[model samples]
Target: MNNRDEPANAVPRRAVLAGLAVLAGAAACSGGPVGPRRLRIASSAGDLGAGLADLVNRHLRDVEASVVTPMASAGTVDLIARGEAEIGLSQTDLLGVDASVTALARVYDDLLHLVVPADHPITTVDDLRGRRVSVGETGSGTAVTAGRLLAAAGLTAGAYVRSERSLDNATAALTRGDLDAFFFSGGLPVARIRELSARTRIRIVDLSGWAGALRSTYSDVYVVRNVPTSTYQAPPSATIADATLLLASASLPDALAYDVTRLLLERRDVLAVAHPALEALDVRSAAATMPAPLHPGAARYYRSVKP
Candidate 1:
């Protein structure tokens, strides 16, 4: 039922394939094996996971790697910690320094979106008093982040009518006017956001003022990010964000780590085809991850490419 009347553009495959061709030269330079090796990565089960899985399958076809698992971003990191997965994509805010995981690179940013009916009186997080809002599914990453954000915005647990629902259910409820607002934490151009935008009038509340406090209090994971005006055909909105990282088991071989990092850095353009949000990955900041130590192979690759 959640898929009913959804509207959005599918990811463009032609652009991604063209970008994938650009990496052949780089892969060859690494003395890639005669055959492709299976590569596994964990991503949450939603647009992020599906888009990433598609990007990896297409771009790494030559290298013979693909994402074989689809799970929540938090679960992805957990699997990495448990040694069941070699790599995983997760929100930086959710990661801890002690997790038996190594940073391969920071891939993209996930912005917090508080959406309400376009005509709703709420203009900021503090205005939700007595309003029914779905912070996100109980125990989900979105819910965890929503709690921190609400606290930072001076709204405590009981300040508003809080509910638990999946993003899809929340979107449906919003469309039906059953709820006052909902929260989504993900990269830009989320399909549901776009679909809702096109079908109904909605507003993305501003949450930028709390960024400094969030960063200061939770240094390892928070950042200030502006959602572009073009993303939803409206004025740009400022919000707090958390970097998304590619993590690996500390025991992963350095050579493989190097290859994975290089492959990602080299084919970022292709990734953009899967999700334009990934265009944010920068070579200059490829090594700018922390808490978790960088895998030696990733460290070597970053040094080689840094100007």
Candidate 2:
């Protein structure tokens, strides 16, 4: 997500604006202020975006003031770094270490799903050699992971007949038997994956074996997670996982950031109703993924809530 370079002067300017924005918001609440305390939030295109949008509409409408715009996950990071959006949602791996976006909370874990028909015989990443496979769409967060995982497994780009199409297209190809398998990374209960499971028998190829290779070759952003058979009606399987984090721009005022963090942590029960995945939020480890330093305001909030 940090492929774009951030300008040197942007950070301090954002810091100043955040302070001013706080004063303006305070004045407004006192009955003599300006417009609503508007916050522009950017998020990914699927469940992550939709789920956050739902939270903002239902809970943050009056508490902190906000609006949400959905876009590619990488694009969202660029927006936050440039101060175009005060907040964003992205997979931790995509944010990398150099990205300016700071993580406020680790929302949930997203798993790498290598899906194939249940009867397809291929049981491991090694078995995918010489087979037609969809790695994910070009420039997608999932695509980045797919490439790294393949390289870690000693499979070059040309090792197989590669399809760099959208998950929708890949799902269609897999359903029609035109592709051997495909890769996807997302929280559980992905609609497309669920639809594919219902339409035909499918199984997620276990990827736990590649976790060590991933850590040794790259960063330790990946982990092994067991996908319950109840998730998609397949037998329990092990795979690699990465956290999805709520990111904030450094320019967002410390006060506003504090409020937002408090809201999310205090309102977990409300959020869990929309998506049970959110219920897994562990505040104790929310800031464990140091993709970037914790924003000062978020740090204050976490410290206040810590026992």
Which candidate number would show the highest lDDT if scored against the true structure?
2
TM-score of 2: 0.80
Score every model by TM-score: 0.79, 0.80
Q: lDDT, candidate 2, residue 14?
A: 63
Candidate 1 lDDT at 267 equals 77
Score residue 232 of candidate 1 by CA lDDT: 76
Q: How accurate is candidate 1 locally (lDDT)?
A: 0.77
- Candidate 2 residue lDDT tens string, 95-171: 75545678678877888999999999999998899999998877677888888999888889788989887788999
Worst 10 residues of 1 by lDDT: 1-10
Candidate 1 lDDT over residue span 1-307, tens digit each: 2233443554456656877887877788887756655556776656444554455566554444445454445576778777677787877788875557988997777888998888899898878999999998765668878888888778886899989888899999999989999998888877778788888887788888888888777664777788776787655788888877788888877887887788788877876775777777787666877756788999999999888
CA-lDDT, candidates in order? 0.77, 0.78
Model 2 residue 146 CA deviation in Å: 0.7
Alpha carbon lDDT at 257, candidate 1: 85
Distance from true location, Cα of 56 in model 2, Å: 2.8
The predictions' CA RMSDs to the true structure, in order, are 17.5, 13.8
